[model samples]
Target chain A: MRTKTLITSMGLFAMLCVVIFGLGVKGLALDETFRRFVLAALWVCTWFAAVVGLNRAAASDRNKSFFSALMLLPFDPALVYLVRLVSTLVWLVITQALLVLLAVPMLKFDFFSQPLMLAVALMADVGILALGVLLASATGRLRGGEALLTIALLPVTVPVFLAATGATEALHTGSGAAEAWPYVLLLGVCDAMFLALGLLLFGKLNEG
Target chain B: MKAKTSNAPLITLALAALGLIGAEVTLYLSYFYTPVQISAGTLYVVTPSSGSTINLYESYRIFFIHLPAAYATALCCTLAAVGGIAWLLTRKDAWQALIVSASEVGLATGAIVLLTGTFWADYAWGSGRIGSGWNWEPRLTTMLILWLAFAALLVLRRAMDTDKQRAMMTAVYGILLGPLYPLVSKAIEIGQTSHPKSFSDLLSAPEIATTKQVATIGILLALVSMVALRYCWNRLGQRMAQERAA
Candidate 1:
C-alpha cells in the first residue's frame, strides 16, 4: 500500500509539473515579466511540494519504522536530516530539469548550452527545497500548518528569490554576467545558511 | 486563601506612558527646532553629495518618527530572537512570554515603519522621476520581509496544539531567521539603492547633532518601555486564562 501510494503520488506530481511548466512556457515565452512570474510560481509550488511530501511521510505507518531505524542509528541525527535533504534535492532537480526541457523548445533557452545558468538554477532549487523542508517539518503537525508555512516561507525566500531571478535574467539577456555574479554569490550564501540551519534544527524539532 | 496580584502591569503602564510622552517631545523637537534636509531628486539616492546640492524638504520632518519606528521594529525583532535563543537553551516559560510579547510589538512597529516609509518614499521618490511610490530598494524590501516574518511567527505559535511544541518551533524559526536582518542591510549596502547612506544625512547641520542624538535616545527608551509593557500585559492575560481554567 505504501509503495502504491508513493508511486501514485510521484506520477501525479510529475504530470502536474509537466502541465504547469508546459503552459508557462507556451504562454509566457521570452517575456521578462513572465519569467519573474514563473520564478515566483516555482518557489510557491516547490515549497508546497516539500511541505506536503514531508507531512505524508510523517503520517505514514510504513515510514515510521524507517524514521525510527534512522533515529536509532549509531551516527548523529544530523545524518538522517542530511540524507533527507539530499533525497529531496534529487527530486527537485528532476522536476527542474523537466521544466527546463519543456521551456527550451518554446523559449529557445537551453539549460545545457549555458552551464552557469544551469548551476544557478539547480543551486537555488536546493537552497529553497532545504529551507522548505525544515519549515514544513517544524509546522506540519499543527493546525493550519500549511497556511502558516506559506506565510513564513515567503519572507525568508525574498533574498533568495531576488538573487536567483536577477542572476537568471542576466544570463538570459547575455549581458552583464559580471554584474549578475554578485547576486549568484548572494544566492550561494543564502543556500548555505538554509542548508546548515536545516541540518542543525531538523533533529531538534523531530525530538519533540 | 487570598491571592496577591503583582504590580508588574501598573509599572509597565507607567513606563509605557513615559514612552508616549517622550515620543511626543521628540516629535516637537524634530518639527519645531530642527531644519529639514531632503535629497534633491529620487526617493532613495544613496550617494553623498556636497552641501550645496542639499535641498530642504519640509516633508522631511517625517524622518524623526520614521527612524524611531524603524529602530523600534528592528529592536523588537532582535529581542524576539534573543528570547527564542534563551528559550531553546533553558525551556522556561518566561522566555516564551518574552518572545511572544516582543513579536507582537515588533509586528505593530514594523507596520508603522512600512506605512511611514511609503509616505517618505512618495515625498522623495514617488513623484517627478518614477511617478510610482514603490521601489524594490533593498531597505524597504527587507523591512517588508521582517514584517512578514514577524506575522508568520505569531501565526506559527498560535497554530500549535501544545505549549511546548509552540515554544520549540517558535524558537527555531526565530533563531533561523535572525541572520536575515544583517544580510538585508549588507545587501542594501552592496546593491546601493535610493536610501541615504546614514541617518546623519537627514540632519540640517553638524550643530544639530545633539538634538538628533537626544531625540533618538528618547525614542529608543520609549520603544523599549512599550515592549516591556506589552510583555507584562501578555503575562497578565496568560495568568487570567489559567485562573479561569482552574
Candidate 2:
C-alpha cells in the first residue's frame, strides 16, 4: 500500500517540483551556488514526499486494522511506534536517496565533496518522518484529515528544514564542517526530541 | 439544552479584575515612566539603504508587549502539555478542559508575539526600512514553528469525530509541542538571531528594566486570567457537547 502511494503521481508531483525549482532558476546550472539551491529544493520536496507517504500510510490503516491489532499486541505501544517509524523512515530515505542521486548528476552538483551534508540531511529525515507518522496516524481517520496533515506537517517541520539547509549552505560555503556543527547539533537535538515524543505519545494515542 | 457557560468562579473574576488593574498600570508605566533606552548593542538600527543608523527611540515600546506575549506563549504551552499528560493518566474531563483552553490561549499569545515581533523587527531593527531586517531570524522562525504546532493541535481537535479521539490526539500533540518552547527560547543563544541578543543590554537601565518586568508580569496576569477563564468555559462547553451528543 505504501509503495502504491509512493510510485504513483504524487511521488512524481514532488519530483516535478524539484525539476521546476531547478529549471526555473536562470543560469543556476552554471552557477556555483547550484548545489545549495538543489539542496534547498531537495529538502522541501523530501518533506512534501514524506508528508504524502505518511498520510497515505495512515489512511490505508484507517479501518482500524492497525490500532485494533495494536490493542491485541503482546508488546508495548512504544515499540509499535518505533516499528512504524522505521518503516516510514526506510521509505523516506529511499526517496531522498533517489532525489540526491537525481540532483547530483541531472543537476550536476558535488554531493560527494561534502559528505556531512548528506548525513545532516538523513538525520533530518528521521525527525520529519518520526513526527509525520504520529500526526498522520492521529488525523488519518478523521474527515478532512488530509488537509490537516498537509498544513500541520508543513509548518512543524520548518526548524528541521532550516537546520538541514543551514548545514548544507554552511558546508558548501567554504566554511567547512566547523561552521555547520552547531546546526548539525541542533538538528540532532530536534530529531531526538521528536523521536522521543513519538515514542512516548504515539503509545498513549493507541490507548483507550 | 445547552448549559450556561459564562458564569465564571469568583476566583477567576477576582483575578481578571486584578489583571485589568495591573495591565493598566503596566501600560501606564511602560508608556509614560520608562525612559527611552540606548544600550550598547541596541543603540543603533542600521538602515541598510544609505548606510545610516537611527535610534529605536520610540519603537522600542513594543518590547513590553512582545516580551510578555512570548512569556505567556511559553507558559500556556507548558500548561497544555502538563494538562495533556494529566488527562492521559487520569482520563479526566477537567484535564482535557485545561488542554483545550491552554492550546487556544497559547495560539492567541503566540500570534501576539509574532505580530508585535515582526513589527518590532521592521521598525526597530530595520529602522523603519520595510522588509529589510527580519528574514526568518532563528528565534522568530522557531517561535513561528511553535505557534504553528499550537494551531495544528486545534486542527486535530476539530477533525476528530469522537470526543475521546479528540482528547487523545490533543494530549499527544500537546506533549509534542513541549520541546519547541525550549528551542524557541534558546534559538537566539545557540545561533545567529536578529533579536536583541541578551537582556543584559536592556537591563542596564534600572527604570526600563523595572518597567519591562512590571509590564511582563502584568500582561502575564491578564493572560493567565484569560487561560483560567477559557479553561472554565471549556469545561462547561465539553459537558454541553457530551450532553448534546447523548
Candidate 3:
C-alpha cells in the first residue's frame, strides 16, 4: 500500500512537471523550435521528478522505521541498498512511463517511435538512481535533506545527463547509430562508476 | 607509537615559501623570458628609441596562474577521493580529516579555475561585449559542474550530526565526485568545437612549456601545504569530539 502511494504520487508529480514545462514552451510547433528544445526539457523534468521522488521515498522509509528494520536484519546493508535501488527503479519506471506517454502528444515528439532514444533514457536512469540512492540515504536523515539531495545529485549527474540529451537528440534526427554510439558509451561508463560506488559505499551510509 | 615531531608548522612554512618562490619565478619568466608573437596585446611602437620589436601576449600570461590552479584543483580532488576511500576502508580519523581538508582546498582551487578560465575565454573568444567572459562551452560547463559539486559536498558534510555520520557522508560525497572528472575529460574529446586551441599550438615554445611546468609544480606545492595545514586543524577538531564523547 505504501509503495503504491509513492508510485502514484511520483507519477502525478512527474505529470505536473511535464505539463508546466509544456506550458513554458506552448505554441512552439512540433518540427520547429519545439524539436530543438523538447529533448532537453523532457529529460530535465524527468530527472527533476525522479530526484524528488527518491527524496520523498527515502524520507518516508526513515520516518516509518523501515530503515531501522532493514538495519537490524542479518544480511549485509549493501544488499539493502541494491534492493532499494531495484524497487525504486521499478516504481520510477512506471511513473516515468506515464510521464513519457503524456510527453509524446503534448510535446509533439514521437518518443515511442524511437527505440534508440528510449534505450538512452533508460540507461540515463540507472546512472541517476545509482548515485541518487546513495546520496538520498546519506542526506535524507538530515535537516533540509530533500533540498540538499536535489542540489547535490543534479550537478554530479550533469555530464551523463548532457550526454543522454545529446544522444537522444542525435537519434531523434534520424542520425546513424555510429554517430550516437559514443554518447551511449559515455553513459555506460558513468553508470558503471555510479553503480560501483553505490555497491562499495552504501553500507557506510548510516552506521549500524 | 613514537612521539610525533613538532616540525609540522616549520614544514608547512617551508612549503608555503617554496610555492611563493615558484610563483615569483614563474611571473618573472613569463614577462621577461617568453617571446611575444601575437597581435593581441598593447602594441609597442617600434621607434628607434624603443628596444621593443614584438608585441607582448599579456593575456597569455594567465596560463601561469590558470594552469597551476587547474593542476591544483585536479590534485585536491584526487586527494579527497583517495582519502575518502581510505577512510571507508580503515575508519581512521586522520583519513577523515584528509578528505575534509582536501575538499575545502579543492573548492578554493576550483573557484580559481572557473574565474581564471573566464578570463581566458573572454580574451580568446569574446565578441568585445561586457560581461561576455563566459560561454556554455562543454569543458567550461564541466568545470563549473565540478566546482558546484565541490561546494555541495562541503555544505552537505556540515549537516550531519555525529562524527561517524559526518565522516561516512563526506566519504560518499567525495567518492561520488571521483568518476565525474574522468567522464568530463573523456566527453570533451568530442563536441569541444569552441574551446581555444591556439594556445596549445603556441605552447610548443620551450620557454612557455618550461615555465608552465615550473608554475604548476610551485602552485601544487602551495595547495598541498594548504591541505596539510587544514588536515592538522581537522585532527584537532577530531580530538575534541573524541574527548567530549568520552
- Worst lDDT 10-window in candidate 3 chain B: B44-53
Which prediction has the highest lDDT against the true structure?
2
For candidate 2, list the clashing residue pairs, or say none: none
Where does the lowest 10-residue lDDT sum fall in candidate 2 chain B? B43-52
Please give me the DockQ of candidate 3 compared with the native complex.
0.69
Supply DockQ values for each candidate.
0.63, 0.63, 0.69
Cα lDDT, model 3, residue A203? 79
TM-score, structure 3 vs. true:
0.89
Per-model RMSD to reference: 4.2, 4.0, 5.3
Full ranking by DockQ:
3, 1, 2
Q: Is the docking of candidate 3 incorrect, acceptable, medium or high quality?
A: medium
TM-score, each model?
A: 0.84, 0.88, 0.89
Write model 2 residue lDDT over B50-116, tens digit each, in one string.
2334457677777888888898999988988898788888988888888788889899999999888
- Model 1 DockQ (Cα-based): 0.63
